[model samples]
Target: MTSVDLHLEEQSMVVEEDEFREGEVPKRKNKKKRSHADLGEDAEKRGICYLSRIPPHMNPSHIRQILSRFGDIHRIYLVPEDPNIQVHREQASGFRGKEFSEGWVEFSKRSVAKRVANLLNGEQIGGKKRSSFYYDIWNIKYLRKFKWDDLTSEIANKNRIREQKLNMEISAAKRERDFYLSKVEQSRALNFMQERRKKKQKTVGAESDGTEEPKVIRQFPQNRPVADGGAQTKTKLSKDILAGVFGGGS
Candidate 1:
């Protein structure tokens, strides 16, 4: 096919003289370039292809060997149906291993893909169709308007954005919870300290009230008269002082 037929856009191409008005300068026209991937996607939109119940041993080489007889294959992809699944060897010696998967095969011609599906769907891979042992068959279906990478990437991006938002919300909630818990702890500590101080004050007040005694005021004579060698006259004894000393009645 010619380069024009391939529809490969140039990043910048000079405009033809006819594209411009007469006597005008031929200006460059910048065009959105198409990559090989874009071309492949555009071509893939024309075909139909899908395979089911693909065995683990089935690879691209196997598909080429099997389907190339039918037509030219544009692309072949055999992917695991579940990543967590393990294809284990059989416990019995010499027994084979098998794992199930799905696949897609695009053909260069749309008609070839449709014909292949019609001929191969429900066909046994291991034996003649006349035998009962040929029960292990493959299922094939035609896919329409399916772009593998675009759909998968779109889904992955959406999941990534959703996970990020959820993580952010969880982090914010945790911070809020921690903040309130700290406030509650501080309030509890403050209340405990206040109660302790009040109890101490009450204990101190009770002890002081119970142990206190009243003070007594007493009168004493600063000057004293001598008795015998420094004897004092009997009339000199103070009447109020004598009453107190002898427990005399008033």
Candidate 2:
């Protein structure tokens, strides 16, 4: 082919390649756009409800099964009773099971959460006559504008504070133990030195020509009695009379 025709063919091939690339770009963009729209739909508004008091021995699974009757439950969190209280109760009653103090439930929709809280609050949990929780009452409330993240943050903060307090108590106990041990060591050292001094004194006494040295007894001075003023005056008068007679004779 001539040079002009060859150059024209090359330009047409380049144009076709560019058109193909533009078509693929729009397809990828469409896919990304659709993915974003699907995400927006999945992130529906969720709501949380608070249970001030959970029935005794009710676990998270039990709570979900009961509350799920009203709406779709997304999540459930039940706070177990304090370990110390649980241990005491178990020992007294001979009943061993997990008990929950409080709880939070998240529903798929806000309206469902609100309706469940309204209907169940202060109502009796009616079930089979033989069921344990049949007579238990509900103490639930719908928490407005509350989020699961907020609850998680609050729990984390409490745990942090508790750990810090425990660390402080342990360190204080260790310090007290160390101080007591040091004092005991000091007393032992003092006793050891006193015993050594006694032994040394005995050894020195024994080495003195096989005869024990005489120990100097310590004597406290006795207080003298004071004479009355009349006695002192009589003695002075007698002494003056004797001196006058002797001087007159001389």
Number of the top-ranking candidate, with TM-score as the measure? 2
Query: Taking the tens digit of each residue's C-alpha lDDT, what string does model 2 give over 106-160?
Result: 8988899999999999999886667788899989999998876677777767778
96 in model 2: Cα distance from truth in Å?
A: 3.8
After superposition, the stretches of candidate 1 with alpha carbons farther than 4 Å from their true spots are 1-46, 87-100, 127-135, 147-250
lDDT of 2: 0.76
Q: Residue 224 of model 2: what lDDT?
A: 77
List of clashing residue pairs for candidate 2: none
TM-score of each: 0.40, 0.62
List model 1 lDDT by residue over 130-184, tens digit each. Answer: 6433556768887665654543465467558968998999999999999999999
Report lDDT (Cα) of residue 180, candidate 1: 100
